[model samples]
Target chain A: MEEIRAEFSRIYDTYNGKIYRFIYLKVESREVAEDLASEVFLDAWKAFQKGQNPEPKIKNVQAYLYQIARNAVSDHHTSKKFKTVSVEGHMDIQDTGDPVEEQAAISIEIERVRGVLKTLKDEYQDLIIWKYLDELTYPEIAQITGKTEDTLRVNMHRAMQALKGRLEPGVTPEPVLGT
Target chain B: MREKDIIAKFTILKQIEPRQEWVRLTKQRIMGVPIHERFGFIDIVSYPSFFRISNLSYLVRKPAFALAAFILLLAGGVALQVTNQKLQNGLSLAEEEYQDTLASLELAQAQLQELRVAVEDNDTEKVSLAVKSFEERNAQASKDFVKLVENSSKKALQAGMKLVQLQKEKSQLERVLGTTLGEEKNEELENATKTLIEQELSDLENRTLTEEQQQLFAEAKAAYDDADYATALEKVWMLSQ
Candidate 1:
């Protein structure tokens, strides 16, 4: 039991930030995201403790954590609709030695992208966030989303296209995938 | 913007991080360390070997004593199993109560929406039906609230507040329809709504709200004053959860 606790402590330290960011983006409330993230880890610990003989061992812990986070977010939305607050002012974007005007432009662009992301379907939003923001590889996303890599690739292409359509109304995105 | 530009912007979201306090607190909780340990009982139970006999020579010299120790350990194990079973049952019951409260709130909201639409259309018959459904669900919710309080779940107060808000809306609806409905019908609805609201408010007033709950309640009131019923209801439900 002590060994298990040590291992879990290590896992929590390693993945807590990524898990929090994943949930924070979806809920857009610091309090709710923190609460949900705590629940996710607590649930994971309980599951680990309850495991007995013949229970399947978790192979990919990061993907497993992401899968748990995905379900938690899904359950949250099913229970109640959340009004996504703008992340622009709430975010703590570090200064990269850029000029003031350049930083302001970046903030504006971030806000615009957030607004457009909110308009997309939840599945597309999840895919885009996972692929772009978290930078999860296709197989990792596939494991979390329970979709084939091929399916995810197609979904990603369509999601990007849809996002382009929303961000720039008159411009059509070129198809990145060949027939 | 191109997909690459979007990705670059998305990268900014990674800057959001969990507070250091939360990370430390969560780890402590997962490790079963109480925030405040008034006694050493938890430590003894959590690490039983520390309290157990470690002297091999002492145990080897007395077989009967060893047998007695083994029997005592077996009995302790059984007792622990029974205690665990009771704890599991209690948690399961609490979860069921939480789900019931959520379902009742949801039903109440749907009924309220229907009442709003009916009132807007000025359909007396539809209004009456909506009111009847609302009253039935509201009464069930009240009963559930009482059960939850009896069960001693902290959520009972929040659910009771929601019931109070629902009753307030019912009173407003009654007042709006009073001029058109018969005096007898208006009086009946008014009396029922008033009694329910009074009961819930009395229950709420008896229990002091925590500072956090007080803040939420104040925010909910502000939202209500602004006529944002949805946000008000959301805050109240959040308090309940």
Candidate 2:
């Protein structure tokens, strides 16, 4: 019991902030991030008590965490019952102070990228974002995405090619001077 | 292939921020669970439901357990501090012995040189006896030098061992720390400790060693020329300190 208390204290001291930041970045609101961060710990606690995380033999703790976060996000989306809240109802965007505007600009860009990402299959979107945005390794991504390394590599290649094809004509409408 | 396109896409993605309310709601829901359920800190206090009537007393014993845990943590911290001080004292003593041994070596070397010069100048009758005396003294100084070196090496090894132990302890402590707070909230404290220790160790070692070692080397050289091997060894030992 003493050992367990000490262990809990140590883990809490180390990871509390990083987990919060990760959730905050994903959710983009302090309150939401705080909530998700708490849930992540709750999930971690349950896993620990059940002895389900046996030294992370299959997936690293970090990867496991992202997986949980992904599921949470997915559940959040689904629990809304696919009700497409009208654009006019999105009052979260009403406040347009300079900082908020700046954030909105960045979020807008992210949304645009997400829209394009929606064109691809879920696996492609996950793979591309986990690789590029989250910067997870192939093995790590494989653990999270449930894809083999070979498949991840092939999909990544295909995803890049597809994105390139979509983006090239729009970005490179004119020839360069050197060419 | 196209950096521009990739950057554009990333920029677009960055703009679509997730609703902040989702994080808030998630946190609220998560916090609704008991602390033990939050990160697996083995909350025997809150887990009374798992056990039958026999374990009800154990669950009711949380306040006492929490108090005991707090006391134990405080004791551990105190023990760490005490161990640290003991190590520092040991290092200081080893350093002092090393300095004394180096000074002795230098004194012996200087005496040897003086004896050699005396023999060359046909002052053998006068300095041959000095030579014999110095040789005996040199042997003693050499023994001291060896002992000093061994002592310093042992001290270094002990310090390294302690560091390894501390690192393990830190790792264990980190896991406990990580489970308490919500994820992402505790990174600052962790990073701060890591950075402070890394920076301070480098700075302290550099500043303490450079000037001290140079002075001891100069003293050792002077003692060597004076035919004082004992003094020379002591000075060299000081450099290590």
Candidate 3:
């Protein structure tokens, strides 16, 4: 029991934020996303406990959490638990010590891209969020979504093109990271 | 828009995160199971496994059947124990019987050895009488018959040599037994008669002989000097008697 607790604690710390962000992207409601995210972890913990002794129930824990999160969101939507709302949420504050003008300019660019990202279909949004924002590889996405890597690759390309078409002209983005 | 720009835009979602206090509480809620729930007997009875004893509730519901089942189990154990003891007793009895048979075999072998000694002595006496009879009949028997008397005659001569060395007695008998009716046989016969005379004289020491026995001893000495071994043997036996 202690061993499971220690291990589950470590898993919860590592992926809790990312899982919340993934749900938040789909639900677009911080409150509903938090509830669903908590439910996903609780369900995963119960599964881990009830697993066969000396052998685990889950193989890829991160993918399983994402899979559970996906189901939670799907079930929430099926049940019609919350209404959709549009609002300009606050941006994450960072201490990069940039000029006020530069910081404001980057924040505005991030908001414009986010707005256009919301315009895309849920399918396209999932590929972009998991691939770019969540930064998961195609194989990891495939495990969570139960799709082949080839299909995800083709769909990712299509999703990118669709995002590009929806994004406005002359939106000149900030310098890409790691490039 | 460029592909890089699109990816860069979506990357902003990385900053969107749940509240720290809410994440902390949620982790507590997921991990905070009660002690009783961890080891719940209800779960064990409900679980689909061998440990589920709920199906056996009918056994407890009937007292007489339960008592009968317990009595059967106890009787089976006692029967098994009794069978084990009987097997042990049979093994010990078989071991005792084996020891008795071995002892009986040894006693039989000892009795057989005594019978062998008695038969060999009886054969010596018979061969002695047969040799005397053959000389009285002028040696008419075949050579094969002489060979047959050999083992008994040799032992009889050794018995008559009272204090002679056993090797001397054996060599003298072997020499006579190996010869036929020839000069060598006569010489061996004379030598054997002398040995017999010496044994009779040794016996006569510290004893006063009657006049007749003294005359027989003198005659025996004379016959032995003349190489008349048969007469010498006859008078020697009379003196010995």
Candidate 4:
């Protein structure tokens, strides 16, 4: 039991930030994200105590946690606790240096892209967040989404196309770059 | 915007993060305190049940419950401090045994080094005196270890004790290796002892060993009497050096 708790604590320390960020990006409300993210771990802990952790038993912890966080966000979407987009939860864009000026410009561009990314469907948002941001591999993404790697490749292509369409006005549509 | 720019902008969202305090609190609520064998020293700020910080937050935030929480914490703190004091008091025997054992281990390792050099020089009298000194040190270590190993439920203690006994056997084997092995059985015994001791002392003999062995032993005793034998074993190697 002691070993179990210590191991889980290590797992929590490793993945909490990423899990929290993923939930926050999807929900866009810090309070709801906190509630749901904590809920995700609590749920994971329960599964873990039952020797039902998908990690160690099957494959990787990253996929198992993202799967839990994704379901947690889905549960919140259907629940009364979720808000559309809380004004208080608006992200404070941070960074700087002519190098500073360039950084600030980049930050603003990131926010602009974030706005457009938010406009995309949640599934598209998840793909972009996992692929381009989290940089998870196709197999890892497959474990979380329970989709085939080929299907994820196709979805990622579409998500990237949709994001690129919003970010650029006049761009020739392409379905595959990294895919 | 280009294709690269779109990908870069999306990637920049990686910087988005929840507040650190929220993360901590959420983890506390989600994971409470980790399970340790026991909390001695000033390890955890709260006692087991009373300071489950997660369970208390909502109640503690209530207007009526703040003073009650403070008083409960104060009482828990006092009780924990008293219990820890008793545990520290109880640690004296283990501390003494560990310190004495560490001394014997350090002495044995130094004597082993002396024996090895004496053997290399083929100095019979010097080798004899070193072996005699090592025999005495090995004897002392055996006594220290017998008491120490009795308290210890460590595979490491068993392995370490085997190494020490092999040192005694080395008094015989090196004598044989110093001259020549008697028969097939004696030759095998000499070979095995040298191999095991050499393997065990490979990393250990390289150190300029110090008082850390005592502390490591006592910590192993205090931390996990049965569990942290590997640390105790490391301390044994520190001496076998």
- Lowest lDDT 10-residue stretch of candidate 2 chain A: A170-179
Task: Show the lowest summed lDDT stretch of 10 residues, model 4 chain A.
Answer: A92-101
- Which CAPRI tier for candidate 3? incorrect
Candidate that would win on lDDT: 1
- lDDT string for model 4 (A1-179, tens) is 66778888898888887888788776655567778888888888887787744435625778888888888888877877455556442442332212323444565665566667767677777887888778888888887888999998888777766565566643333422332
lDDT string for model 2 (A62-146, tens) is 6666677667656655666424433221212222223323544654544445445556655666676666655569988887777
Query: Which of candidates 1 and 2 reaches a greater TM-score?
Result: 1
DockQ, every prediction: 0.26, 0.10, 0.22, 0.21
**TM-score of the B chain in model 3?**
0.26
The estimated TM-scores of all candidates read: 0.46, 0.36, 0.45, 0.46
* Residue-level error in angstroms, candidate 1, position A129: 1.9
Flag clash pairs in model 1.
none
Candidate 4 CAPRI-style tier: incorrect
2 versus 3: better lDDT goes to: 3
TM-score of chain A of each: 0.74, 0.56, 0.79, 0.76
**Which ranges of candidate 1 are over 4 A from the true structure?**
A52-56, A80-112, A165-179, B34-241
lDDT of 4 at A118: 66
